[model samples]
Target: MKNFSDIQIGNTIGPREQFVSKDECRAFAHSSGFAAPRFTDDEGARKEGLPGMILPGNMSLGLLSKFVTDWIGPEGGAQLVRISTTYRVPVQPDHTLVFQGFVTHSVPEERTAEIDVWIENEEAERLVTGTATVRFDK
Candidate 1:
């Protein structure tokens, strides 16, 4: 939103795509202190009964944040004050992830709003769900 007043309940951002290869996820895991084997190696993930190396929960959250920010654009007038997410499935590497969000509540007087967000795979499986509070600076 260019201004806080532009926000309306039920207004949506996107079903935008975010993709990461095994190399990218591994690089993120290693740098961010989440470099456990299951997140770094397919073999290690198999040992844990997973099909392959997967992104950790924190990485998923970061991707969610990126989605919101990208939607807000470069000259953002909104500040994501708070965000909470629940992970439902493992986010696999080299996959097309979709990020979508909608406003659930709006407080125009306070210049704040609550947004519901979710990330799904190409197959339409929800990998994570979350809510965020954003304040707009006029």
Candidate 2:
């Protein structure tokens, strides 16, 4: 198990790129019950002046959560007690999505910490930003 305290503030966790495919987007849209044409149809998105098909905001956060969980592992489970995020830009299915996070603050007595999270592209342009509270206890 990795120690959460060892991770420093402003440290980048992952630039792990994930390609959001059309089939994946459609499946997610259906599963999430999101009926927005921007997330479903390429033509609709283009007509709306968007680049292409857009991914759901929650889906991006879901990817972030997965990254956190994987980092924390079994013996060191991080309970995501709270999260605050803003979608700065649309995530196109054709582009690679990067999930990155950093330790912002630590409260050892409370066995909790705050982390700033973001998703960016290869060019390092931030598409989303957020804060997350993680609880570490045995």
Candidate 3:
């Protein structure tokens, strides 16, 4: 079981093996109750000057959370205490996004760690920035 200290500054966890397809986006939107037209209809998205079906913001956030969770292991292994983020751009359906992060701070005695997160496309342009805190019980 990995813990907070296991992750290192400048070390990245994943460009997890998943693709953000239109179908995947729609499914996530449906399951998440995100009913915006841009999230479901390509034409609607085009009208809004977007390329195609837009992924729900929560899905993007969930992906980032999963990357962090996978790095720290199971929920009981290290609990996520806080996360703050800002979406800088949209993730269209074609690119392979690399979700990356680094350890920003640590308090060994308190068993807590802070990490900064960012996601980039195949082109390497950052799309999101976030900060998170996790607590290691063990």
Clashing pairs for predicted structure model 2, backbone only? none
TM-score of each: 0.94, 0.87, 0.87
Compared with the true structure, all predictions reach lDDT values of: 0.88, 0.79, 0.78
**Cα RMSD (angstroms) for every candidate in the order listed:** 1.2, 1.9, 1.9
lDDT of 3 by residue, 1-138 (tens): 876557665665565546677777888888988667798888999999997776777888888887888787654688888888798988776567788888878888888888888778787888877898888886
Give, for candidate 3, the lowest lDDT window spanning 10 residues: 9-18
lDDT per residue (tens digit) for residues 1-138 in model 2: 655566566766676778778878888888999858899999999999998888888887777777777657766656878878799988877778788888878887877778888889878899988888888763
- Cα lDDT tens digits for candidate 1, 1-138: 468777788899897887889998998999898699989999999999999999988888998887777777888788888889999998899998899999899887888889899999998989899998888897
What does the lDDT come to for candidate 1? 0.88
lDDT rank order: 1, 2, 3
Where does candidate 1 stray beyond 4 Å? none
State the local distance difference test value for candidate 2.
0.79
The regions of model 2 sitting more than 4 angstroms off are: 3-7
Alpha carbon lDDT at 118, candidate 2: 85
